[model samples]
Target: MKDQHEPKTQSEWQTNLEDIGAKEGFYEALGDQHTALFVERGDTLIVTFENLDHVYERGADRMPWGYDFVTSRGWSMLGLMAHDWTWYRDSEVHDFFDRLRDEGFFERFSNVIFYGASMGAYAAAVFSSAAPGATVICISPQATLDREVASWETRYKKAWRRNYHDRYGYAPDLVADASAVHMFYDPRAPLDAMHVALFRGANIRKYRCRFMGHRIASLWLQLGILKPVIEGCVANTMTQAEFYTLLRRRRENGRFQKEMLQMLQKLDRPKMLARYCTAVLARRRGPNFRKALRAAEEQIARTNK
Candidate 1:
């Protein structure tokens, strides 16, 4: 496959697609082949493989793109699309990566940081495991397919079983082989918390947060969590201690305060909202923080009236 970055025009893009189809055997077989390039001054490249299930619908914009955060740090971004809620083996995804490897796309880069949140996290963990010495960061990852435990299983029953046979699921087995793995989860989310436990024996690090929710970790991109983690991975100096500190700080420092306040207001829980906002404001003191607290207060006052 040619570098998707080389396609400069409509005709060029079409021709590139045709070439990829020819090389890969069929265009329709490319389950989720969306690629974007961000050029920056750096020797390290971050290849973020997004998870399955409504990726194009929900996560296309959420996953770190546009190089806003990465470019400033002098690192480039490569985003990969997965099989979309369907269970696919690492070989299937690596087939795409192998093509890029053969074309010398990753050769110029010195360090590669593989990141994904949720199911995408599963993909990142699986793909990075195959590489000799690659760093992987997964947030709210599912270690195995437990139908009774996974809330999303009802929506993705076929995909879950298809990926996991009678014995093991993807992340639980693949994580053992990774060079370094960082798994993050919220203790409140039982499924994700259980998923974090599967990486106990390997070079895996675990982080547990309170009330941060499943998607909170991926928001690291927006909340400024990706920078330090990516930098640490590249420099080989990142520790779980530092990673958790960042996670905890982001949560307490007004990252989820607004959303929690909104939820509290909608549920007509003014007292809870006030208490939560008070705690957040106490830790995070600033004009903007106060503004958010006042906004929550206004919502509570309005709802009561």
Candidate 2:
């Protein structure tokens, strides 16, 4: 609803999650501790890690926000929201997942899809370990923000202070038995790419979304393939080819067109930039493409001179 940025304060963010959960008939559990909410609407449950910023921006009217793309397929929703990148290390958070396992909650569902990006992505990968046969979709997920383990990763320096050696600490170690883990990250983002490198196992399939940086999920949301891909995961039909086919929508998407245009310009590939702009222009009339086209043409004119 509002521009989707991380919320500035926890009070406002928590309030927003509560408000939306209430309006959507989603019951809350341990909100003060880990802020978990779930709606039991169907046999298939989609467990998602909702960052505070995303919830505060996308309110209740748009029920099941982050998983909006896939939730429409009639799957129940379980939301495990965090205050920050708590890495879900809190005792309460740990106990919550343990209790779920003790109570056999996840097994009740016919299928479970755990999803998140960045900090939440780390949590998704970590906690999905509780459900042996669930599907995992992590976008720009960190293997661990722990400085000790990820000392090579200089990014998220603020998160380094947290202790990542505790239970469910190492993200890669957590998903040993998941049915399948799909990791997406941009190689251009050295930190994210490095994090992807940590998650190794026969079950893990890493997809490189080059140039799409740490917030690739936001970019895919613009391209409109985010939902279809996740839905395919739930349906057990999302192959690498199907995901790429869905990603093809980016060819006409304004965000992808502009990102590619900017990169091509910086790379001094004027001819390629012009070609990209012309292709996008033929499909849609937009200011970004028009301006990029002009810039690329000007660069070409200078080059020819």
Candidate 3:
């Protein structure tokens, strides 16, 4: 038999949420589609949105994306989980938020911040309207899936059919009353860039991640800058200069280097590839870099001959 204290399995994670909910704040099933898990800590609250599939994929013991991070700072957390990629478009879910707003739940917190990535980011942005002055930090968030507003969006085909004409429909418009909105996305990602373009207002602050693509959140986590970036945002201390300075940590990241090398290879620039590999190998032992450098040298020699 497994130890009672052993890490909870994927299914058990759901059970665990229920258990925690029974003891602490509350965990309510919004509908057959979504669930809400609230854990109170400090006066500040970090509201996060996540896909249940992604949560379970993280292995047994892992919690929501910002669960550990938020709690570590002694802040409260309200994790909104979607059963699938429904984009959290459910009447029950809307009603739940409406209830929370009516009860002045958000007003209890000294500060409130809505956070997520991708689809979750879209939810975070749209839902921040529930608390007018809340700050929003999202990565690669879609402004809307409404075909009328985002005709060029070919992705999230299922979501295209969902209604974006009602309350909290247009993410960009919903976030207009927010105290601040920070958007992170790679300008290199055509679709992502196009989606972000719909968001306009003085409250919007866009951070370009360049070649980082649509999954800049994961990359920032890998580079060990995710937490600091969030901390800065929460504290209202994040400046463009400070963010870029923290982003420099990517220079030593293997994945970052590999992606850069792949771009060089795609451009057929062996010289730049060689120099990149040499620089990486000089500072650290990278088998991939070493191998690429050899191939680049061979290509250069053949071209010279």
Candidate 4:
């Protein structure tokens, strides 16, 4: 049976949460939330470093990509939600991890998977060391936005203000002891790709998600492969080949199909474009592909003249 730290009433829970997120530079459910409730339910736990915007975008009710997969079977979730992209370096934040370690929080779970995307991914990689043998699945995670180490990262300049040399600063160094580190990012996103390149070590498993943009997590979710990929990561069984095979599902994804059409049209091979579009239109009826097929036919006519 799974255990839960049930509050007596919804209002009580709301009141409890209020005392939690009211401080500046302080975060949501950080120091005040019940740590026991955080990992009380299951043998498997998913730790996520999240931004407040994500909560606003999806609403707090929406679970992160991997949480739903393990909930039915009994798994715990600890979302280290940041009020902003603070890079998770506050003194209280470090203290929270200290408490968890002293209490042997990681020891309670048989298996744990730490997950996040972008800045959150950076935090996951850095914090994974706390759990020693746990798996870390991060998408487009920065190695360090610290100006000293990565002045090339012109984007998120605000994050550079925070000190990355602090306790859990360098992500790559922090993740060395983890059982496995699975990082996904698009080689086309120069900054994200550059960041991933910096996060190198023998323990890392790099998954190249070409042309997917910096929102690799969003793309995976759109293609309906996010959950299963995370499940594989948690179970320590997901491989590069398996990830690509699952990626084949993107063949029907509207966004991918549209991007592919644009890429093909950019090649200027009207003849081949005509054939590819005809083939795609025959299998699936996409408005964008059909329009491209028409445009390709016109281009061929113009070329033939």
Candidate 5:
């Protein structure tokens, strides 16, 4: 039997909560509302919402790439605080957006991108839809208000329901006007892909990355791999195929090579080395039979030392 007292893993926590009564417990724990803003030099905007029961202070460092991207582009940021997932009353979030609109935040900026991971991703998707031409990129987003509320009830039943009812109103109803929606998910995750599929906005893109585990890992991958794609999409610099080619080439070049070499040295395990060598050789050989065997042998010898 599992240790009842031990801290649960994220998956375990989620599962246990679901098995219990997720909806009832969640709505009872709603707390204070707070928001923070970070302004950059350029005319871009990024709004982030925190997860349930999480304070923004705890998660500020979680998205460095997001901060870096906005600052680098001279954009400004708005970070919302939710005592738990249910902190943002629907009126509050909408009013916040209205305030931004009134201040010409979106109108003045050349580009606006709404981004978040997990619960924050849910907020980004729902809110960005309200902006006329904003682009949204969500990593592992929860697709529905009802599901999220139900799932949280195990730990925060009352707060969850209250939040679902009071703040967001409903998840499906929140995403009616998104300009462009892109979602990334791990295929192995236990949750269904309904949320990602239901985003029938004007422009929608969905990608499944099998290697990265669910949660923040996928977000990190997006930083390294999706940056250019996002920039291209926003700036109209390259088509998706062209952008992907560029990103893949960059990964294959010196940076990825150096990183892989360092990892090999650290692990110092033969099986890993062999796997690495095989992958490298296979990538090089393409469809050629003789070249593959020769390349694999060469890689093995090099790594063996």
Candidate 6:
């Protein structure tokens, strides 16, 4: 048998949760497919969804997404981890939420926020229905993988086999009663935009992150705007203006600029590429950007000749 200190199994992961300073918490298996790790702290609760493998491989600490960040602020956390990309479509998971609602687990909290990204984002949005007035902050979420509903969604083909037409199926519909839903997605991603279109509602605030791709959360983290943005949303203090201001930091992000340059090159937009590279070079010295600039200049000179 492996040593107790080595967190190689789900049970061990649960054991490690206790070491992370949970004032009052419990880790329960929602089935073989999902696990719930609840850490009680203050009046505010931030429920997060993530892949089980992701949580395990996240870092040396092996905590859930934003676990430390939320806990340090004296907030509670209930993290749902999926064993795979199940889109959290399971009877056990549904019953767990039902039980939480029945017990009024959410009512104890003065404020509750459901947060996640990508596949996890879909789970966060759909499950927020368990706590009707909860605020949902989902990045690059899909409305539903149902064939009839989101037929345009060609991604997550493996998840299409799961029943999305059932309970907690349609994320957009389930999150309708939420007090506020903050959705962040790259408008340039066609499928993601289509998914965003399905989430239309007065309470839904759509933040278009043009070039950030589907992994907006990771990109925002790299840009150093993730913590503040999440804090603002959790505090109900995030405004459209404020969010855009924070997103402005992406202009200086190396990954963002690199991807933008690549996109420009792929589209054969030498003029736009030249202008973009010139702006990027003005501030920072990037070997890739310099090479791209030189190529763009050569293309421009050739075209002019």
Give TM-scores for every candidate, taking all chains together and pairing residue i with residue i.
Answer: 0.62, 0.83, 0.92, 0.82, 0.57, 0.93
On residues 1-305, what C-alpha lDDT tens digit does candidate 5 reach at each position?
Answer: 54564334644533443333233211111223534344545676666666642334333233223555655665665555454455355565567666666777677767777777666777777667456677777777766546443453233233454445533455444555556666767655546355565556556766664434455333344346556655665563535566446545533443344455455546655456556656765565423323433555666689779
Instruction: Give candidate 6's error at residue 120 in angstroms.
Output: 1.0
Q: Candidate 5 — which residues are off by over 4 angstroms?
A: 1-31, 38-40, 50-65, 81-91, 102-104, 147-159, 165-168, 171-173, 216-223, 236-305
Model 3, residue 163: distance off in Å is: 1.6
Any idea what lDDT model 4 has?
A: 0.75
Candidate 1 Cα outliers beyond 4 Å, as residue runs:
1-43, 52-78, 87-94, 97-109, 146-155, 165-169, 251-255, 258-305
Ranking by lDDT: 6, 3, 2, 4, 1, 5
Candidate 1: residue pairs that collide? 51-120, 53-85
For candidate 3, write residues 133-195 as lDDT tens digits: 999999999989988878988888977788788797889889999999999998889999998
Candidate with more favorable, higher TM-score: 4 or 5: 4
C-alpha root-mean-square deviation, candidate 6: 2.7
Candidate 6 lDDT by residue in tens digits, 1-305? 64556677656667787655345688777888777889998999999999544555574445677887988999999988787889999999999999999999999999999998888899999999999999999999999999988787888899998998887988889998999999999999999999999887899999999888887887887889999999999989999999999989989889999889988999999999999999999998888889998999999999999
Global CA lDDT computed for model 2: 0.77
* Number of the candidate with higher TM-score, 3 or 6: 6
TM-score of 4: 0.82
In angstroms, the error of model 3 at 95 is 1.2
Q: Model 6, which residues run further than 4 Å from truth?
A: 1-11, 18-23, 56-60
Model 3, residue 125: what's the lDDT? 94
Judging by TM-score against the true structure, name the best candidate. Answer: 6
Q: Write the per-residue lDDT of candidate 1 for residues 1-305, one digit (tens) a residue.
A: 54446665645644664565455322323334343333435777776755553345443233333345666677766656554464344444556655665677666777777777776776677666544366787877766565554545443465654545332245666667556787777877776776776667667877676667887645665668767776776677877788777766565545576666656667776567667767776776656546656776887788789
Candidate 6 TM-score, C-alpha based: 0.93
Clashing pairs in 4: none
- Superposing every Cα of model 5 onto the true structure, what RMSD results? 12.9
In Å, residue 21's CA in model 6 sits off its true spot by 9.4
